[model samples]
Target: MKAKLGISPIAWWNDDLPELSDDVSLEECLRQSRSAGFTGIEKGRRFPDDPTVMSSILKMVNVALCGGWFSGTLVNEDIATNKHRIQPMIDLFKAVNAPCIVYGEVGHSIQSDRSRPLATKPVLSDADMKAYARRMTEFGEWCAGQGMPLSYHHHMAAVVQFEHELDTFMKCSGEGIPLLFDAGHLAFAGGDVLRVIDNHHKRINHVHVKDIRGPVIKALDWRTQSFLDAVALGAFTVPGDGSLDFGAIVQKLAGYGYEGWFVVEAEQDPRKNPPLRMAEMGYAELMRVTTKAGYVVEAPTFPWR
Candidate 1:
């Protein structure tokens, strides 16, 4: 099977290192991604938010905008508030021709209405679940009408972190909305990545090919801080170096007939690992895993000029 691979530009943005800025420029990032063998890239917040600018960049590099995460409160808020947060993002994404907006747990707590850890008391009651489902359905329908899909993200520190929470969210959301599966995040949250895909392969629309160091992941608990916090602390990394079984994941995705982009998403501290080297290493690892799993990995075209 022929598969298109990509990388998240966020992999190049590490807050801990100031000297690495030169390496993360748009031109350089695209150059490294292509040289390292990625066919596309997911736009990060550091990229220009304006649709025209973003479109121009993607066109220049011959890389597709795979999609990005929208960190807004969708599950535990009123419909109006949720719409307010998501509508503009959807419009912006539409303008760029991106396929989906990765949906994850909101920052605030749904139960206490106060700022609390995402793994705090789950606020999803039966009524809340139904309402969430209705809201997600509405959002999915809206996105479909606009020619985009809402790919829900199962984050480690979010409300849908654990297996049960993921199960509840998927059950409540029904069949309309698709999911953006992040292998590392699921593993960090104590989920069986292969099993989740096996059960809900149909709902998976995109894949974030990230991996995590088991020791680093086990050192932190969701009850203490958010997943984004862990990301800032360099909790995740590229495949092969971490504990995830990418060979199994690739085989399972292939079995499920998934043909979407496999985006390399390592949100780590670049101070520890330079972004360019990381991208090169990550691409090599991804290629090895894909090839071992009986898939043809395409060589990416370098566009440094």
Candidate 2:
């Protein structure tokens, strides 16, 4: 199957840290995305909540709506509470024709924290881990039934960030919960990207393809810097411009027969990197690598029913 290329608006107007590009308009985000050869876009803060409004706006740029992040508080809340929180978004998603919702556990996440470092982020005990897994799996199953598949996102400041946590979650999660394979975050958390793809590709329903600046990562007092602090300093970057091996990663995905959006998402300051230029660079390198891996990059379309 052919792969689709999309880009997130976070590069233009970050939702977590709006101050990053608070002035960049949603119109410019989609326009630059189209200019950069992306056929789809993930949601950002400025994006219209009304599906009709969003669809009409995207039509001008000829970009499809890929998916958007859905913050889940299931670690501290029950499945019902989390489901209620996500249902409204799922309703809007159906109208915009999004394939899935990117589920991120933010109950104890410090991805947006600036005062405290990432090292002091949240941790779940053994029982809490099991409870989270059960709730997420149940919620994910419900989401799929609602035509909005849940693609769980693992981040650097979340309880599910480490290899052991991720493996446990994957082991406990039923078939309803699918992995949102994010190469950059996996690498940022010090995990092997290819190894993760080899293990979880079967359960992957979505993908986020980004690169990291190794020097910046190495220079960081990792225990002291927050995820947002790293972003402010340009820790993440487009694939070819950074140290990540996109060719090997794409080859591995092809081997797994992965089919979905290879969404280019590098959370960098738009003023310095220029979202349009970075998007173009990311798209070009992804195309080159995927093609060499015997994959075709195509226009975006809804995959989940």
lDDT of 2 by residue, 163-190 (tens): 7788888887788899999888888888
- Among the numbered candidates, top lDDT falls to 2
> Positional deviation of 208 in candidate 2, in angstroms?
0.4
Model 2 local distance difference test score = 0.86
lDDT of 1 by residue, 139-197 (tens): 77776776777888876545566777777778877667888888887888788889999
Candidate 1 Cα lDDT to native = 0.73
Lowest summed lDDT over 10 consecutive residues: which window, candidate 2?
Answer: 296-305
**Candidates' RMSD to native:** 4.1, 2.0
The CA lDDT at 290 in model 2 is: 85
Clashes of 1: 0
| Best TM-score among the predictions, by candidate number | 2
Pairs that collide in candidate 1 are none
* lDDT of candidates 1 onward, in order: 0.73, 0.86
| TM-score for predicted model 1 compared with the true structure | 0.85
